[model samples]
Structure formats: C-alpha cells, structure tokens
Target: MSEAARQAWPTVRSIPVSAVTDAKPPGRLRPARLEQVAGSSGTGRDTTGGGTATGVGTAGAKPSAGSASSAGSASSGTHARANPAAELGFSGDPGQHGDAGDGMLHAQRAWDATLATNRLDNLGVNAERQRLVIKDVTAAVGLLVDGWPADVRACVQSVIDHTDVSVLALDLGNLDGAGDVLDDLAARYPDRVAVWRVAERPHWRGGTATWGESRAKLLRLDESDVHVLMETSIVLRGDGLTPLVAAVAEGAVAAGWRGVDPADGREAGPGRVPALTGDLMAVRRSAALSALPEDANYGRNADLELSLGLRGELVVPQGALPVERLGTHDVQADYRERESQRNYDGVLRMLSAS
Candidate 1:
C-alpha cells in the first residue's frame, strides 16, 4: 500500500491465523486474546495485563449451547423467511452499520454508504447458469502416499478444507509413518476420506510400487466420475478442483490446472491441448484406468503420457485456479532426473506419432 493509503487505513491489531489447530483436528479453537490497561484482561479472566494491545472484543465469551440450538432452529427455517440477511448479520439499516465505536466509520468507503446498504444478493440467483456444478457428477481426489516427507497431513487437510469431494489416498508402505497419518485422517473424516494401505515401497523412492501401478490402483479404487491426480506439493487456495471436474463433465477426457504442448514446445491452454502436467490434473476415472502408463516409476512426464493416450479433449481452463505449487517432493534427485528424462523420451515418441 502507498503511504497515503496506509495512513488512511485503520491499524489492524491482530489477525486470526487458522481456527484449526494441527494437534487437534476439528477442535473448537480457543479465542481468549488481548491486553489493555494495567492488569486488565479482555477475556474477562482475572489476569495481569500490560501493553498497548487494545481489546477487539471478548471473543473468549463463547455463545451458550442453548443459543446455538436456537440459531440452528432459525437456520432450518431460513427458506420460509423473507429476510434471511437479518439472521446472517446483514442489515440495510444505517444505524446497524458497524463502526469503530462512538459512530466513526472504519474507512471512507464505509462512509459512502455503498456497502452499508448495498444489495449483493446471490441466494439462488445464478443457480441454473453456473455450469461448474452439473448435477449427479461425483468427484474425488486421488493422491499417492509414498512417505511422510510429502506433507501428507497438511495436504489431506488442505484438500478437506478446499473441496467437498472424498479423497482416495493410496498409501504405499507408509514410509516414515505416512500411512499412519492417512489412517488418522481417514478416521477423522471417515465419510470424506478413504485409504488403501500397501506394504510395498514406492518405486520412485527406491521401492517396488511403480507410479503407473499405484495410479491405476487409485483409478480402480475410486468410483467417482472425475478422479483428480494431485501431488502433495500442490496446495489449493479455493475450490480449484471443481472447475477441472466441471471441464470433465463438459465432455473433456482430462482437464488439468496446467498443460504442455510438446509438439509446439510450449505451455498449452484453456482449450484442447496435447498433454497436461500432473501437479493438479483431473481425469475421467474410466479413461485414466486404461491410459495411465503402468510401467512408469515416476510422475514427471508420466502425466503427459497419460494425457496423450486419452482420445478426447484435454483442457486447461481459462484463468488461474486458486492453487499453489510447493515445489516437487523430497525425492532422490538422481532418480527423479533420470526417470523424468526417460518419461520425456517416451512422450517424444508419442508426440512424433501424433
């Protein structure tokens, strides 16, 4: 922000990181915070406080269970209500507009009354037009669990956080208790997560479990129409997988977050592409079962090999998905380098024929 803009903005005291604690999955996060006055606690607890950190609110005071039940009842009757926004804390009344205490607007933007009375209604507004959520098309994310070094816990949690689909995680010899982590997540989200444990080690990590074999196993295990191939290194910012699955529903054999056209020697895109990257690719489980290279021991160009094998459209949707790559996994450099080159050679042959 510019100096002027910085000056205009109110100083944000503290920001909540994540409510979900790593140690405690799906636990109610504690909220007591802030120190103001000499030995004054914002949380109403008797504690000595020192510092200029002002009390934002008594967040420590949780709502009563009875109140929560009442709120739930009110929510259940939402469809019958004419003014549901009132229940959701939205108010057209100017007096109800939030302020910085004693009737001061937080920002000049608030003073304009644009947002205070602004109508941003979207409850069933575009329900019919949005093609991304076509009816009856089930989807699930398929990820390999080679070891704990791949951030399995965080990756599974991220998938659970961002998408509504079930996760079919294939655990190949839970290298370093990685399979245990999958078991924990499966227990935590029994309805949303499933794990297949194999005693064989991963071929890429110097194990017998080959990439093609495990990927094909995942394909066979998953019954969803759209099966996503996501590496643990990939993190999503939002429902990034939805659009890819939507593209599949729209009649594409495969749709990935990124694409490559080896024929043209460049990245390809929002339409038909020769191949795709496997970092975050979604495919039809039916097609993927037969197309995935069973002998490949690594991903690298294996994804592209699968892409080329598919007969229909391979799409890279327009605009960026809310996803971030956390680089490649902590695999052996020599193994990855050699395997990647080998896979590329195979892709080269496929490219020549096409």
Candidate 2:
C-alpha cells in the first residue's frame, strides 16, 4: 500500500479490543474468542490502508468520529454484547412494557389469595356481631345553653322529669342568670343534670356558644351514646329526648325537630331533612362527633356542614315531641345574623365543591 493510502486508512490506536468485539453482529461472533481478546494484553496499535485489515474483519467498523469515543468506552468486552433485555427474557410484546402486565397479574393473584383466606361466611358473622352490638347501645343527651336563666332552668327541669338518659348542660358566659340557674339545677337534679360553665360569650346567633368549639369541648368532656344539642331557647313540652334518642337508636345517625325553615318558611321533615335544626337535635355520639370539622368556627353554619359531611347517614324527626320556640333574645341579634350568613356561605361553598 502507498504511504499516502496507509495514512488515509483509519488506525485502531487507543480503541479498546472490547469495543471491536461489541460491534460484532449477534450470534455471528464467538463469545469465547471475545473473552480471550479482552483478557489479552495485546495493546499494540494497528495501522492499515485500503479496504480492511487482516484478522480484523468488517465486524469492528468504526462509527462516525463524533460517537466513536462513547461507543469505544461502552464496548469493553464480550459482556458488552450481551443484551440486557434478552437476559431478563422480556416479552417483546409492546403491551408488556416495564412488567406492567405482570404487576397487574400479581395484584390480582394477591386479591384472590386474600379472598381465599377469609370466607364470605366469616364476613357475615362479623356483620351480624356488629348489628347486635348496635342493638345494645343506648343514647344520651347534652344540653348547650347560655342565656335566659329561667328558660334554661325550666328546660333542664323538664328534661329531668321526662327523660331517662343523663343530661349535660354547658353554660356559655352565663346568661339569664344562667350560672345560678345551672347551679340550682345541678344541685336539684344532681344525677340527671351535670353543669359545665364556659367564660366566653357566644359568637353565633342565639345565646348558645359557638357550635364548633362548644360541641368539640362537650364531646371531650362527656361520654354519651347520643349527644343531644338542645338550644335553651326551645322549651320541650313532652318527652322530647326519648323519641329523639329512640330515632337514633333505630340506626339513625341523627334526630331533631321537624320544623319550617325560619328563613324561607319551607316545611322540613325528618329522615332526610335539608338540615337538622341545631335548636334541638339528637346525634349518635360517634357519628356526630366524627362529622365535626377540625377547625370550624362558631360563626358559620356548622350544623349544615355536619349534615353535609354525614350525608348518607340516617336523620329523623321526633314527630311526637313538641318543642315550643320561646324566641331568641336581642343581645347580639344583628351580629348573629351576619355570622349566620357567613356560616351559610361556607355551607354553600362546601356543597358546591361536593
């Protein structure tokens, strides 16, 4: 070959033999010979001209100059030619990308295993036990009040005279001389009436404390099967709590007064009412307690929020129980109306989101 021709021909200097071996076609190259070449110390640079060199067939054809360096580094030994996908025995079915089908199959198999481990009959037994447990449960009441000491006293006295369940009266800021009234009621009916005093004034309408914090506080202090949220403004003429508690006892999550909405004068019924009048409502302790929002304020329509959260849960009205509305006091009427609107807005927001 002419010197010029030899110079023009590509030189395999600095290119690893491994690179040469990896560039070989699959199945055409011998793995044993490739391994041997890799282990060999033959580091001499080869210079050639014309078509190709002896012993170095077209297998080690050099790629473009740009990719040659990277290709050379990657193709170090016979192992370089080994297909990672082939070693994994990957099914080339495009559907089997990243073992996704296998993952789904494994998930199905796990579900089947779980189903096999626990028979349907076992589940039935558990459900029956749960129903029996609920049958044995009895409901209790919690009265939330703040003002009109005579009204609170009268209301509590009626509850003592009529209902068999325990009543917890939470006095908020002590209105209508409620502090003294609560004290007298507590002293008179020590077993039935348990009194708690809150120093803060009610932020919501009516003389009652804020529903959110007040309800939460009451739940924390008292352990009752049913929690009756009774407003001191409403006077009970009959065994109001008994029927309410009975409604809750019949798998109902909540029970309250069936009345016309004060704002619209629309008749609201029991079972699935638009909202439970907070003035008088009996809630299953677990259900109502669970429905309360963590950071809910007293100003917004908290009762509506609670109802919305427990949408599918049962709600009934104690039809036989007559609750006489003695009307709300004027002390914070305007602020209460504004706060109620704020709460109603919150309820609308929640409902829209749902």
Candidate 3:
C-alpha cells in the first residue's frame, strides 16, 4: 500500500471481541410521571414534540388505571397536583380577561374548556370570538314580572350589556308595572328590544297568558336561527348566551344552563340531563315551534316534552355560565304542587318509553 493509503487506514484502537459481545444496550428509558390533580378532570391524550409517554405515574412510582396515587404517595403527606393548563403555558387567570363590552367571560370559559379537552394550543382567542358573534341568535325574555320591578330592569340591562343578540318580550298585563319597564328599555335601545303587550296575565296567576303559548309565539315571531327561552328571573353576570348560541350553532337542537334527567320516573339532577331548565334555554326556533305543545298552559314539564320530542342533540354548558336564577322563591306552593304533578305525569310518560 502507498504511504498515503497507509496513513488513511491507520491501525484501529482495537477493542476486545468480548467487550463488543458483552456490551449491553442502554437501560430502558424511564417514563415521565404525570402528577394528577383533584377537583378537575381532563379528556384526550396530550402530545408534544419531545417524545412519547409510555404511561402516567408518580415521580417515584407507577400509577394505576383507577387511582391517581401509588402506594408511596398514600403516606407522602403532600401532593403535587399537576395543572394541565398551567403546565402547557396557559398560566394566566381566566377571570382577568376583561371587564365588559366584550365576551370576556365567554373567552375565559372557552380557554378552560380548551385546556380540559387538551386543545388549548389548537384553538385561539380569535376562533372563540368568532363563535360569540352569534348574529343568528335572538333572546326571548318573558316579562312575567308579577312583582320584582328591579329584576326586570337588571335582566334587560344584563342582556343588553353582555350580548349583541336582540330581545323579544311579552309583557303580560304589565304585572307589577313590568310592562312599563320593558317599554322604557325598548325605548332606550330601540333597535335591540322588541315588546308585545298582552292584556292576559300568566296562567299560573289564573289569567290567559300561558307559558307554552307565549314561548311558541316568541318562537314564531323570531326570525333568527336560534330562539332563547329565558325568564326575567335569569340575571346574567356574564355573556352566558354565547355558549348556548355556540352549542346550537354547532348542531345541538337546544342548549341551556341547568338540566334535569329522569330518576326513577321523576326529574333529578347532576347529569347531562335531557330536559333543559326554563330559566335559560336556547332552541332552534323552528324546532321549538314544531315540538312545543299547544295545550301546555304552564311551563312545568314542557321542557322535558320538548327535549324528548327533538330529533337532534341536546346540551347544557353548565360550568361556563355566570348566571343568577332569581324569582324561584316567588312561586306559590299550591300552584307549584298542582302544576308539578301535571308536569311530572308527562315526564313519567316520556321516561317509561325511553
């Protein structure tokens, strides 16, 4: 071989054959321990550019499928709960978004939901705002103000301040001067509030104004894509309508704040219930008119019947609302008991078939 060739192929710093044979692969890479937190839950797996996670566990031990803690953590006397939102760089408080004139509450809730669903990085603020535009939604707040005149003003003002949706109201006999209040509000915001004064009073008060009938009238009168069935008792502290509007736009037949499901042939709580509460519910106007019962004099079980009659998805954005349900204490016990039985009978019939 030439001198250049010899220089190019210098002798190797030879390693032993036994050394190569005995060499072992690096120990299996240790999986990261995801510190789980209580008081909240998350859905879907999270992925980043770093590497795959084999499993979830604690720092010093493995995690079980049903339990968040390991044997060691049981006696640790301290816990390091992981905030999935904070961990993913969304470290700001949702409450500090804004004060008013914008859907800050809606934004905060959306951010939280994004975090819970492991989609924080994907959905941006602009996307959420787009959903809040809600040009196709209108609110139907009934003026059954038998007494609380202050509630009427607050309710109307809250709707006007929080959302861009137009309002339609039926002032039944101007009970407790509520019709005059609605008229004043309509005058103040002429383009926003629409009022219909009726001579009859609410059915519960023994007059001609029926709950289902009035709701059906509003549904018919509304030209918007969605019609919100809200009571003046529902005083919103934030832009609650946006979430319901968003849900309806996203294919839900109807959406509401509180909901009830049949439990042992009666209404109960705490689940993604089928029947939306009348305090605040938004339904497709056409669908509502179609399903609304003509004979339903009071508002009692009509929500359940309407929900059951619908052929599409029903949802409730429970935690996302900052709403105050008022006027519940104003309901008369005798009237409540009688109407409740009538409503319960309908609810039972629906439950039996399902």
Candidate 4:
C-alpha cells in the first residue's frame, strides 16, 4: 500500500455486538416499523435472516394489536402529509407525469374511499339509522259548497279512516248544505275533527270567503308537526298521509301528491316545476305559517308561489299516494280557466322580474 493510502485508513477497533443488538427504536413502535418498511419494500423476507438489523433486534417478536393499529395510523398520516406519489413508489416529481399521475392519484383515492366504506359496513355502522317519527299531523280542508255534500262527506270520511291526523274545516257559507255536513262530521268524530263555520261564501262562487284568508286561518288553527292543505275534492284511496309526513320529516319544507317543476326557466308547468301543487300539499307547520300569503284570492298558483318561497326542498311522491279526486271535474270551464290564468300570470311576472 502507498504511504498516503495507509495513513488515510484508520486502525480497526472491535466493538461488542451486544451494543448494536441491545439498541431500541424511539417511542412505543419498538423495531416493528423497520420490519414494516422492509415488508412494504419487498425486502422483509430477506431481512428475516439472523444477520440483519431487524432480525437481530426483534427476532421472533410480533406486534400487538394496539401497536399494529398505531403504526398503521402513523403510516397513513405520513402518507397524507407527504407526497402521495412518492409513498406509492413513483420516482421524481409526480407533476411531471401530468394526466397519468392524476389518474393514478384519483384511482388510489377512490380505492381508499371504497375500503373505508366497506369497513364501516362490516362494523354495522349504518344498521342503526335513527328512525323519524313525526306525530300529530293536522289536515285542513275548506268547504265552499261548489261540490255536493256527499263529496264533502266522502273526503272527510276518507281522512278519518285512512289516517289518524286531526281534521279542521272552514265552512264558507255552507253552500249546497256542505257546511251542515262538515258540522255533522265534526260532531260524529268530535275528538278527531274540528269545524269553523262562516257566513261568507267562496270568492269563486260569488260569496266572501276568499281562498288565501281562509287558508291562513286554517294555518293559525293547526297545532301539529305538519299541516296538510287538503282540498274538499281530494279523497284518499289508501294511507297517503304517511308518505307526505315522512318526506317532511326527511327535510323537505313541503311534500305533495302532485308537483310541478319550473318549465324552461319559467314558473310554469309542462316543464320542470319549482312548486308542488296544492291539491294535497303537506307542509311543515312552522314553515308554511311563515310563508303564508294571506291576500291571495284564488288558490290556483298561490301554492306554487308558496313552495318557491320555502327554504327547503319540495317533494311530491305521486306514486306513493293512492289518491282520487272527487270534485272540480264538473266545475264551469270558463271560471276555472280565468282563475288559472290569473294565477299563472302572477307566477310568470314573478319569474320574469327575478
């Protein structure tokens, strides 16, 4: 050897093997982390030899459940805080690969999300969903005598038979003996039905009980979780009230049997409707009370306006309701057309301005 090369090499001193083998890894992880890193890198089997650091330090030692969980959590945290691509074995800058790198990253994230969801399912996390029980729904119907007394009786009777909700009726001038029928219903089902009779008649029939004012009065009288705006013409063929109530409890401001979505950006039908029809509208009592429009003379498009003004979703479960109509089919065509046009005009104007 050259004199300079000999001078550069230091004299060898023997160190005890116990000094290296006895050393412990920092924190509670012990030396299992080294084995984990080696396992992920595909070199753990080779490192299992007695001469390797892991084998010497942690021979025949297995990680406990708690330590394994903690180590897995720590590894996940590291992966999140550091470049994910590097953790996944990608070399150099991940941004340089552009689309390919983005695709892989997305795939990885998707897999992680799926795994988490599956884990939650296995643990029965979703098996205990909280049940929604909305009690004491109030059904309100306005009587104008435009339909027959039998129709009114059938409508009220269906409500009492199909559901246990309380019934409240406003008898407007008792046209065609409809008021007397409502009084009889209230007397027959005294505990479940309440009636308020008025001398003023409906505006459509040429009396004084306007649609908006009468509906607002019904709203004021309701003392329940949900208030049903039912028409004297709508008769339930099955338990239609439960679905509407469930929808309200599920977060909708109002739920109805018939609904329309706004059509071509206009507050009109034959297109998407932003409003539910008032035929058998069920609304959260407080929300309906807050948005009630008292001056509306005809109930036509007034319901649509109220729905659009609500703060929550409008849901109409049409198929869920086994409902049949009993009145308005025999009404004068000209009067219905005029009232509908008036309401649609208001809706159009509101849409145009907004």
Using Cα atoms with residue i matched to residue i, what is each candidate's TM-score against the true structure? 0.63, 0.56, 0.64, 0.58
Q: Against the true structure, whose lDDT is highest?
A: 1
Write model 2 residue lDDT over 1-354, tens digit each, in one string.
233321211111211222222222222111211111111001101123222211112213333333423343355544554444432234555565445455434443444543443343234442343234334454456666657877777777777776666777666666557767877777777787776665565655343345676766665555656677776777777666655654455444566775333345366653335456667777656556667763454523667667666533334442245568777655466776676777777677767787
Between candidates 1 and 4, the one scoring higher on TM-score is 1
**C-alpha lDDT values of all predictions:** 0.64, 0.52, 0.57, 0.57
- Residue by residue across 1-354, what tens digits does model 1's lDDT show? 233321211111111123221222111211112222211111112133332211212222333344422464455664676654354353657577433342223223332332222221123222232233445677789998877645888788888998788898877776888877887788789999877666677888777778887787777666677789998778888778766766566556777888898766588754446688988898777767778998898888888899898867676665467898776567888998999899989999988897
lDDT of 1: 0.64
Clashing pairs in 2: 140-226, 149-176, 300-343, 301-343
Residue-wise C-alpha lDDT for candidate 4, range 238-312, written one tens digit per residue: 777776665565445676777675444333221113677887877766677667666676788877777776666
Model 4 error, position 264 (Å): 6.4
Off by over 4 Å in 1: 1-132
Tens digit of lDDT per residue, candidate 3, span 89-117? 34457754343333434444444454444
In model 3, the runs with Cα more than 4 Å from the true position are: 1-147, 264-272
User: What is the Cα-based TM-score of model 1?
Assistant: 0.63
lDDT value for model 2: 0.52
Between candidates 2 and 4, the one scoring higher on lDDT is: 4
lDDT of 4: 0.57
